[model samples]
Target: MQPSIMLLLLLPLLLFSAPSISTAQDFDFFYFVLQWPGSYCDTKQSCCYPTAGKPAADFGIHGLWPNYADGSYPSNCDSGNAYDASQIGDLMGSMRSKWPSLACPSGDGSTFWRHEWEKHGTCSESVLDQHAYFQAALRLRSQVNLLQILQNAGIRPDGGFYSVRGISSAIRSGIGFEPGVECNVDDAGNRQLYQVYVCVDATGKRLIECPVLPTSKCSSRVEFPPF
Candidate 1:
């Protein structure tokens, strides 16, 4: 075969064997909510317990109602706090600077939470909102150097909560990214907390679901990579 012809055939094989390139979603993760502690499913697309990756999992994307009681779960979250964009932005910036690999967006976590808030359109909002906001951002957080963000935010990566109904429904629907809980264990018994799960697309654009825990908070630490 001609030298040029031989090169062309080899090039195709080399390209085929090359590993796939990483995208935003590879660094980004998503979490769908099955239900809030007190809030009920408001729409048919919404439900108390839903599959991991379905749209119905977004039912409790926002904070839960404080006054409403759902069977056993009581709303202990502070539902009276106002949204603070500045503080959230500051924290996000800090996280971004610390972890340039994951490339966290610069802005207030409250802004995204605001969208969730608008989705819910309920009066329930509080310090708990701050907790949820920060945790959601951490879902995409990388750069093992930024341990302080977890510490300051009070997020236990090793502890998280999931809904029984939501897990079961996810098992039945079998259409979404089967939801699961993750945690981060710190020194000894101290652990970082991550209450929200934020799922993203390849470019990190689509936010499929953003669930809120009814009463329990989960951890967000990644252990395999040894962070």
Candidate 2:
């Protein structure tokens, strides 16, 4: 599991746009994973990557942001006991380096604590501008689930998990691949549990399902989280 601070750091990154991915349908890995409406795949790249990247496996926090480093992941090509814990460590360090001012750090500015700007408090407009930055950070931390799933499934050059995406209500209701599921053990010795789903919609924003509470909308237009 990621430390609470690192997860907080990624909030801003979720609020913004990620780099574009080429989804030409011929020999493109993305072709196997992304699902979208209509022929829009030719022009719109928003829902292409993050949505496609889901279901490859139940990556932990990485499930939130699949477009990291141009979308080719498990760059080390090692998995299982063969996996490198050091690489995961490197990812943590690298993320902090890329966005130091974000909420990945402990204390103050933590995502667990709402920003004064979010609260419309004493902070000025300039401070409020930072909210976009925090949202992006949140999105990235949410992708941790992808990394865990990749490692758990031993994804590699010779063999790896395969993910496919489609918007059919039938598909979503079937027993096929699930994009945003995460694994977590209960502290009280209960069985592991499946967390919410995370994904980007056609509008490129984030969404979450509380089931009991109303779905919380994120800054990006089409993103959605695990239910």
State the weakest 10-residue window (summed lDDT) of model 2: 26-35
> What C-alpha lDDT, on a 0 to 100 scale, does residue 192 get in candidate 2?
23
Q: Candidate 1, which segments miss by more than 4 Å at Cα?
A: 1-79, 93-111, 115-133, 136-227
Q: For candidate 1, write residues 18-120 as lDDT tens digits.
A: 7654221211222333222112222222222221122211112323222221213222233445445554665644333321121123232345355443433
Write the residue-wise lDDT of candidate 2 on 79-135 in tens digits.
222322242343434333322221222322223223321332112122212333234
Q: How do the predictions measure up, each by TM-score? A: 0.22, 0.22
Q: Global lDDT for candidate 2?
A: 0.27
How far in Å is the alpha carbon of 200 misplaced in model 1?
19
Best by lDDT: 1
